[model samples]
Target: MKFTKPFLVLATMLLISSCNSIPKNQEKVISLKNAYQKDFYIGSALDTNQIKEKDAGVSSLIAKEFNSITAENCMKSMFIHPEKDKFDFKMTDNFVAFGEKHKMFIHGHTLLWHSQLAPWIAQIKDSAAMTNAMTNHISTIVGKYKGRINSWDVVNEALNEDGTLRKTVFLDTYGKEYLTLAFKLAAKADPKTDLYYNDYNLCQPTKRKGAVALVKNLQKNGAKIDGVGEQGHWNLTSPSLDEIEKTILDFSALGLKVSFTELDISVLPNPWDVVGADVNQKSEASEKMNPYPNGLPDAVQIQLAARYEAIFKLFTKHQDKIDRVTLWGVNDGQSWLNDWPIKGRTNYPLLFNREFKPKSAYNSVMSLKETKK
Candidate 1:
């Protein structure tokens, strides 16, 4: 009974199911035409199989609402290189095509990360070869997507939990020069691209200090750093609202564009249960995943809505400093929350409910216009 209208897909699916008029389920999809004004990229962590020309699952939601897209996996090093000495654009090209077809702003996810890199990239321990290879890779990817991507998360998760250099191979081989060179190379390759530094725990003072210092060093070195992407992968109660607002202010104070690159709030049974002894030590991917309870009763769904209201209220309070807000996944079924942090927790922390229906949280975000009322 929410204020939504039946989308074409739902109508079609219903017609096929019963050969009649639209089902009542899609009545809440009110025409969001011009619902958003700012050119911010409201996107998800993964694009799903939409690139494969399928219109089901996460793709449907993104197609319905978003005007921008970020490849959660396509731009990563591992997907680009499952084997060394052979780079494949097979999957990446599909993502690029999807972006253009939808006219969605294409955001290249990452240029460097300690994790998710190919084993071969890790083998380049020497400075000369490492630097050359890095340069080549950056040029190829950025150049390939020149004038294509809306922006790029030029670097991802470069700092540790405590804000220290993560001892990544790029760090060992090239040091701070690696950071500068990567940004510079990306700029030279794609002069129109927006380059950024992406990281997590950025709200923590320790990590915040490290990130600020890194950006400061890069600015001093004449690097053309365009933005800083705060990976908004946060929990329910941690990273206080004050800290989140202050973090944006501090980063924006540096005169760099700021955005939330991969954001998701997990409503776990216990937010602190994934630490130390409670952590899942499983090695196999299957052992690490289990079905989320999906048993969040109706009342709890509205509770989720209030939490979203508070967060969006914060966003409205500081809209000037924020460039974009991206949810990590489109909906519950595809969210990394099911297996992330603890590997098995039924977390309902997004706008869309399990039935692909908008929750009260959805109305809260939709009504997040100016927030003064």
Candidate 2:
């Protein structure tokens, strides 16, 4: 039917309105959280800056992409209990509030780790005193976040590369029994929170064997072992896909949830012998090491995308056994890799760039879920 100019315009407006009214689910979905909504929770570790909502953009991306959050440093023993008698929960309280505000799953980074322990912990001479101190620390900290936190890295990096327990003060004083003691204390403090043994280099056969034995022993002693976290601090190469998959399968075989905790893919050079995530290890910065000081080359960026895609592909494959895959940082600029091994070096290792924009790697991972459809 022929219509006047005003009627035609009205007709066109109505059509546009009807199209816009289409359901949100019918739209082109391209979010990391939406992509993996069925697979597992996508998580990122937040430092004080982000937890305090320093940048609205960073916080927005976090609330948009991630469904789980871990404190990068605030929840650590060093930060939570800096002084012998004092326990600081100010920043951590804010962190937990942020997670709760966003309705995100909260994961406590660690209860015990040799590196970041307060100085007094290392100075305790008597075995009874040391044991009492540890009990107090775990009880107080874990008790504070008892019901709020969803999981805790009960013990971190407890094994040496050679498949032996690291001689930390806890191990030195209580021997291997220290591990079970820690878990037992955590279980008592928060029966609802999932307790985990988190460590780096778990993909290595020797380390994997050690982790298996550790978990079995925890189970043997009737400790409440809930999950194991394999820190995914890998690069474009190394730690073959088979190795990662094997670690996941092996850890899952224990009937405990597995997490790819601290996930990042550093696109920088490392010393020939540097392997595993030992915070103490350092290599002097050099021109050769920081080749991408200015920016990642296109080729390297492509490789980074592929690396992340491959990792997520494996995550999807083992969705049943995996609980969460948490990136170590929110974005490349905030990534610890920049200053870790060698200070003052630029490294691109996260799914987002310095500006909080999703990189090709982010798209690559999101595409995995789309392709499955």
Candidate 3:
């Protein structure tokens, strides 16, 4: 009650110091002046929230990475067939137009996918009707955007965990031959668009082996397939450097361009304390029982950044083998990390910080020694 003026000033200074010590939202505030930017392409998904004509973040990313945009879910069958007899071209058109205006390359997410297909596609008993419907859909939608989309996920997620053909409307009706037909159909629709088979966990040996065989088989048949999309949804550790390098080499030997598509490495708190969780999960985990904390400790965050550096380093070494590098989502806010593997848990596996600013991964990527020589 009787404090002197000096004591009050000291108290105020201490309070201010503590407040400044707290970590603020630094992720979103990126400087447009980062000089070490790479010429390698950078892109994120375009959604309802991000479709605005004047998005500074999007614009900056476009300015920095040159708008190599990826269509997220719109080109999929689900959005196309929300109702029959009527196809929605709103988002697809917007995506293509955005890329055109920005003079950036656009990727057509998919011509065929098992998870996001329409319900009615499976009911057709007549094989011809089914084939016609598929052909019509691809020829219409993809063909409509023909000269626009530079690359296409001609088929997405068609393989099961064991690399066997997944049972979906496409396989059941068109049989295993549908994949080949789909690629050929896509090629015919747009002879110039690069056709790709895109999927996740491609770095794993078991899955990579299957994909290699599949791509080689497609090549033998003279399918105009152009590339492989390795969805890099990696964990903190799981896939070792050996696995990823071998994977890149294995796919490259197929004479198909390789793209590290949909890449995002999660660096969130490890839930090792949970019951029935594997103790020795990934090579990077420090402990099996409780791998993650509320905020990732500084030590682990450094490892996370190093991991990003290592991946990019590998990418640089194999730059000749890669065609494009696309992240899964635009930012952490839109990432699938929220509901995947462990639903409802906070995950931090992206280049942008939670605040949308670039993280250490950004610096590491920019600092990577280009191996293009």
Candidate 4:
């Protein structure tokens, strides 16, 4: 069928408009897990709601983006072993089952921590009693998930900012032996599972030295430690890229793998000069403190993107030494930062927004390798 001159002209115009609508670069967007699969595991911490799959959107995002999972609260001593004699594995079991269903690496957070100690365990004053408590707790928990859980934070935040061992109930009662004892117990319970000493402020020279000393002490005592976790609870600035790179290299030099567990970059003004992950610290909320009550501005979003890009670039550079990078939460709305430092403040921290959609930071991190190539 031959078209008239006007009909032919209109068809040609229509075809040109359709071609313009299609993007010139049609590269597919990669999932977080797939983007770094060859380098290391990409993970996220799951709360109770997420574990139970209460929110389908959150669950779907987690399955698609992360290849590893950590229980944000349930696996801690406070929740898993609430009572001295009673062990509750309700939520903990669900957490493990979810990870297994997705074929993700399951990380058990905090076999021993000072902050969330059970009241009964904290009240025990006798060294023998504390030893039994520590042994029982570590053995029972670790043994139960012996082959299932891939790794554990055997000890968390045991060092003070000055790099000395913090005087906790464990340290006061069991002395420095508690560190080695916990690791030894975990190693005995699950010989195949990886054990790590995790802490915050590890980027600081003093604290980094403390960690190195602690690791050496554990080694001297014949404790089996596989890696060290530097809790990446950072802000928009501070903890310079050089400090982070040094921390990774220093830990790697110890012949142990490095992981950025609890990774989140807060884009908010810290109330104090030095930022920390101390749960006890609190600041009264004010209008100035809660700058982005509605949402982050475009300029601030751009800055966040750049910050994530720089950090991921460093991670990609030393991918061989790193084992995993786990985000603290799945999205900004669920981030613990919202209530930390200053309560009731809106904070944008993670790569995903409140709606479980990728933010500028997410795109920046995902495209890091692409830009290099």
Candidate 5:
């Protein structure tokens, strides 16, 4: 109480120094991975550059904030086995090492898809040769990552909008048996890894029915099936909250784990008359379609954040049945939405922005975990 002015200033300086000396770990804020550690994993897909550890910030952010890693494209058929005889494991090996180094759960994107097929497989007319090629391709790839991969999207985008099998080269050659064959082959290669049937727009009635039938048929045929991946490539307005929840519940009813394999919300206008979530669909870029050329407006950003909050809330409500939810890309700039459907358009579909900083959507989603007990 009777201290001199110099002594009072010295005491204040000491207090300030003590406050600033807090340990880095204590000063660190909770990251997405830390926040959702108990509920479920929070993951983002890694493009080529990320897998190679070329971008220091992205690599560091991934190791710091995520518990899972998915190779963006290296595992695809075209990239893995570009020809009938050759098999390339260069980038794929890099991806596996990257994931293993980070101790992240590795999810193999796809084993079978009509698109991204090697030209030789697509050109094959003989059914027997086609079947042999398919078997060899699946066995080799799955065997390479046998115990390493936690899950595999064994088959992708196989159902048409009307609930019938889309006629691809696989189906044309092997009929409905092709689906079963793919699952069986993957299972044989890695009995431990979870085999999944992944597709987009499972929220639609027809696609949902088709998927249910496919899983049931696989079970009946004694094929080792593990899960279904509903690619959450959704929009803000379309695919109502009810429909999305219905899809998750319906898929889980099969006693199989469900995953949001490729989740992204495109904050851009779509071309007229597009009904289903077909990744192959494309339209000419125009002023009307690419409305937010410069950046997302404040109003639109709020809408995007609210949409993400609602989706995450639904996920939290059904965390038991859902195994994992992975964002399609790390940031808006790396999103595939910018190219597909339209060539050179800006789309803010991810939780992070171009600068590798969290957006409003990230905050909204993370707030769920914070407010939880």
Candidate 6:
């Protein structure tokens, strides 16, 4: 039978309505790793709960968004090698397995750090004893995960603000040669793994110069150093983009890859005198410091989104010179800032909220390449 105009119009209308009724969940979910896969690896530091997959939501979110992983604390000296004669790999083994299961790039946090030393290590006073301890620590840990770990932060926060080496137990016992010694030991353990010198406040000219000289010294001594990690634990306004760009240029000039490790933009009031990520620093919590105890205000949320957008734009601009960008933690609830500088205070710092949902900042970062296209 020949269809009439009214019948044909009704059928067409029903088809259009059916198409519009498609479920919202059917749309593609954007993965952070896929967005910048060509530029650099997208990573996050995993805490103990995440490593064990205790919370299915947390584990699923990590596998979906990130292409790389770092242990937030398990691999550190105090935890891994709690005793000079004993080494624990229970949690560390699980962390590495999680990364390998997802086929993600695994990075070991640090080999030799001034802070987080085992009690026995700190008590040692003799030079020979310290040398033997350092050698045992580096060789044991690095050799354990040789090929499984892609890179290691061989030396972390070794320099002070004045462009001078901080007088840690390692430095006091071994002198300036300790930096060279650590890298050399790491290279001997894992000849193929990349070794890095990581530090905070590296954007400052003096500290940046100190890092440059440190890397140069290691080079002069024929140590294997492949990259530098500028721990980007920045706040809402400081460390101007110009300073960040200059840092990228300066570090890249040394012929080493630059990584923005442990990045998070804290939306909290910081004490005026506090600087760098010194774990020892502490301040009493008060109402003024914990202004947004309930939740972040709409206006402040918008500002946080803008801040993240500006930072990611810079990263994309210099993707060639950069190697990786790893957020400090998976979500705000797990952020170290909550207890750091001030205890029992709320802080919103990561791209995801406490509920594991992507916030405005996540959208701003994910939409970057789209706008460019």
- Per TM-score, the best of the predicted structures is 2
Query: Relative to the true structure, how large is the alpha-carbon lDDT of every model?
Result: 0.73, 0.91, 0.72, 0.93, 0.88, 0.92
List per-candidate RMSD values in Å. 8.6, 2.4, 11.1, 5.0, 4.0, 4.4
- lDDT, candidate 1, 25-86, per-residue tens: 53343422234445355666555465665766656567777766777777778778656566
Steric clash pairs (candidate 3): 27-356, 27-357, 28-355, 28-356, 28-357, 269-292, 270-292, 272-289
Global CA lDDT computed for model 6: 0.92
Score residue 336 of candidate 2 by CA lDDT: 88
- Give the lowest summed-lDDT range of ten residues in model 6: 22-31
Span of 10 residues, lowest total lDDT, candidate 4: 21-30
Clashing pairs in 2: none
TM-score of each: 0.83, 0.95, 0.80, 0.92, 0.92, 0.93
* Per-residue error (Å), model 1, residue 334: 0.5
Question: For residues 139-198, what per-residue lDDT tens digits would candidate 6 score against the true structure?
Answer: 999999989999999998999888899989988887899988899999999999999999
Q: Worst ten-residue run, lDDT, model 3?
A: 274-283
**Model 2: lDDT of residue 228:** 97
Q: How many backbone clashes does candidate 1 have?
A: 7
Ranking of all predicted structures according to lDDT, beginning with the best and ending with the worst:
4, 6, 2, 5, 1, 3
Q: Where does candidate 5 stray beyond 4 Å?
A: 1-29
Identify the runs in model 3 with alpha carbons over 4 angstroms from their true place.
1-39, 53-58, 268-295, 369-373
TM-score of 3: 0.80
Give the better candidate number (1 or 3) by TM-score.
Answer: 1
Residue-wise lDDT of candidate 2 within 255-293, one digit each (tens)? 999999999998988888778889988988789988987
* Residues 1-373 of candidate 3: C-alpha lDDT, one tens digit per residue: 6999999999999999987784543323232122223434566666655655457776556446435778777878878765556788887788788888877778988888776677677566666877887888888887898788899998887776667887877788778878888888899999999999988777777777778877877887889889999888777785788888888788888888888778888765545543111212232333332345355567866877899889877876777888788877766667776544455555667777656677777666655532221
